[model samples]
Target: MRRVAVIGTGVIGASWAAHFLAHGLDVVASDPAPGAEARLRADVAAIWPTLAPIDGASPDRLTFTADAAEAVADADFVQENGPEREEVKDALFAVLDTAARPEVVLASSSSGLLPSVIARGCPEHPERVVIGHPFNPPHLIPLVEVVPGEKTAEKTVETAMAFYAGVGKRPIRLRQELPGHVANRLQAALWQEAYSLVERGVATVADIDTAITHGPGLRWAVLGPFLTQHLSGGPGGIAHVLEHLGPPTEAWWRDLGQVTLTRELVETLVAGVDEELAGIDRAELVAHRDAVLTALLAAKARTELP
Candidate 1:
């Protein structure tokens, strides 16, 4: 798409606008919140340097409006990142539906909400409503889950996939709708165990962080869990690895804990993180993370990993 309408200038929306601009698309973003335009511009400016914008790509191409309808007036595609509540989504999509062209695809950056609920806002052409969920900062992360609702047209899916891929994103299409999609669900599985560990006093928060960052996290950065496990099997591959490790793995699964984040647990988790980050400046930590992530992405780009 030559022009993308970002219908919320929050973190995710701003990041998506920056990403689209870096890929040479014109971006028009809208958010009703006070100072949203200025904040969006600043956010885009901060993220621009990391993008290495392509030819014809420039922050100058970004535009802002307080009205979502105005933002999508001439956009070829729309990426919605408004509030996550179902009512808000339905109402917002209704506005987008009325303002945007009939054929233009409207994509939501919702992490867990169903596209069907999002489509409910669009009476004219609910088929154009789809989910284009992205992880945290879209400017850096590549994963975009392109999910279609019950009424979403096959053509809309194809267009969303193509548009996302064209902008240098790694887009995956879900065969059916599911809460939290796939990646987030995978993350939740690990998070659940991590929280359980903390609640049970099995490991300190800092130690748990170390266990992942120095161990499996390092491997996971290069490949997903399945591929990493395949390598763990050596020449025997995943099948052989499963044969040898399946029993213990199943037992461990059976032992895995289920947890509820009660008030006490929340406080404990927050306190643990505070302790872990003691003496570390939050800004510096984020900068270091961004720098390292950029390098990692570059390294992966030069490799043949999937």
Candidate 2:
């Protein structure tokens, strides 16, 4: 098994550590904060029972360190989740380049910043650096966007896809580098519509939640939106649905709002959320999210995969 180093210890980073370890890979995690090491170790331990039951798995090894170089010294792969600021990412990758093997692949859990930006200050920059952006709680969510920057090596992309697949992640090769990548971009599109609807008083916060949670989201759990639509229109496939629904879809696209996150809009959104989640505590919400995500992943594993 390869040794993997997770270069940040926040929730996303800790989740990566948990997944790598559960897959039987030795994971060495590093973060600069004084107590980050212990916190990471504890987070991984807490998530284990939930993870173990997913694939009947156990890690072959584990290690913790505060020094980035020490954490990545002999690692086969480095998964970074440091501060999203370009300068911080550049500095960290530069250090990682010096410590990791020349051929070792480096991946980022960044949701938006392009790989080119993160690779700028590193000696090994383009050849081995690529975005391995995963959905939140990567241990449970399987979609990993394997995005390649302009200078990223062809072989690097292939190796990353293969590597992620080995760990049981569903890796998608995005054709080009785009801010927010694919899934997030799609999500943001829906969010824009949802917000606009709320702002226009067409729906309440809870109504928007129900529309997705009970409607398209249910079928989407089994198949993606396009495929679901295709199935809905019968054997004529995607073409049939498009022929019928294309006009309205195009109209919606044309009318979509480019609303900025203005102060007033932000306040409205925040207030709505506060009202919606009035009685729920943050910790309880997180627990609820984890439980739902676990069940969703398990159901996906059984129903979506062959």
Candidate 3:
């Protein structure tokens, strides 16, 4: 079995550690925070059952240390989930670079930090550094963005991709790096429009959410926007859909409201959310969402959706 070193045993790190363990990979986790090991172990134990364990998986496969270098000393792969600060990351990677083997893939879980900037601290083997950004709560989310830096080696990217796939993640390779990567950019566009509509008195927060949840969101879960459009066009496919809807879509885009979040707007948005979620326990809502998401994922795995 492979060994994965998880530096920074916080939410993302703990999730990654649990995931590695679930796949029967021994995980050595490190974090400097007081009681970090306890918290990480507890979190992993809690999340372990939800993951469909295979390959002789068990939470007992995990070990922890306060020393980051010690964790990576004999690890097959190193996943850095330290604080999302460049200086902190640079300093941490410098320590990691000196400890880990030259060929071991050093991957980051950074949401937006560029891998090139991150590779600055590892002059010895900058080519081995790459981004393996997973969606939040890594174990539950299937998408892992395997992004490479300017100096990231092709071998490193290939290794990271294979490792993530081995752990049951759906890894997508980015041809070029971009701010917020791909999925976040798509979500940001939808969020901007949602915010604009609320600001322009077009819809309540609940109604806007309903519009997506009861409508396009269902289709989106099955396939991406382009493919959904193709299916919607029947025999015409995407080309026909574009020929028919392209002009009107462009018109809607031209009219989308641009919003700047002022203090008042922030308050309005918060209040809107509060009202929408009134009388609903946040924990229960999260539980329901996760339960449904898990079912959806299981169902998707049985298909050739893409």
Candidate 4:
């Protein structure tokens, strides 16, 4: 079994470690936080039952350390999930550069930082470092975007995709990097409208959420947006959508609310969310989200994809 090193033990980081471990891959996790060791142990144990179903129902395999270098010493792959700060990532990369095996592939769990920025820290492994970003709660959401930097080798991209696939993630190789990468760019597009609705007092946060979770979000759970659009067009396909609903959608796009981060707006948004979430405890919400996501993934696994 391949040994994977996880360099951070926070939410997204810990999820990666749990998925790796639960799939029966040997894992060595490291985090500088005071109680990160205990946190990771508890996290992996808790996430295993949900995560194990990805690879087949089985027991987990995980080990952790506070020593970053020790964790990557002999690892076949190193997944860096350190703080988003460049300096912190640079420092972590420096340690990983020394500890990891010569040919071991290294990937960042960064949401937006360019791989080129991360490459600055590990000169020797410049060809090996690439962005292996995942959707939130990665073990449940399987999309892994493999983004290669300007200096990144073609072989590096190939290797990274293979690695993610071997681990059962649905990896997509990005041709180039743009702001927010692919998935987040699509999400930002949607959020622009969500924000607009709230700003116009047309909908509350909860109402906007209800609109998606009950509407497109449910369908998206089974099919991608493009495919859904194609189906929505009926026999005429995309042409039919353009002939009918396209004009209205374009008008809505033109009228989208502007982006601003004023304090009042922030407060309003927060208060609205607080009111909307009054009955649901934060911990309980997380549990519900994970459960629903698990069930959705299991259901999707049974579909016949085209």
Clashes of each: 0, 0, 0, 0
For model 1, the superposed segments whose C-alpha errors exceed 4 Å read none
**Least accurate stretch of 10 residues (summed lDDT) in model 2?**
52-61
lDDT measured at residue 198 in model 4 versus the true structure, 0 to 100: 88
Tell me model 2's lDDT, rounded to 2 decimals: 0.86
Flag the better candidate by TM-score, 2 or 4: 4
Identify the candidate with maximal TM-score.
1
Q: Candidate 2 residues 116-224, lDDT tens each?
A: 8877857755589999999888888889999988778999899999999999899999998899999999999899988887777788777888899899988887889
lDDT of 3 by residue, 42-147 (tens): 8887777678889688899899999999999999999999998999999999999999999999999998888999999998999999999998779898899989
lDDT of 1 by residue, 67-170 (tens): 88999989999999999899999889889999999999999999999898889999999999999999877998889999999999999999999988988889
lDDT values, one for every candidate = 0.92, 0.86, 0.91, 0.85
Better of 2 and 4 by lDDT: 2
TM-score of each: 0.98, 0.93, 0.96, 0.94
Q: How would the candidate models be sorted by TM-score, starting from the highest?
A: 1, 3, 4, 2
- Give the local distance difference test score of model 1: 0.92
Residue 168 Cα positional deviation in candidate 3, in Å, after optimal superposition: 0.4
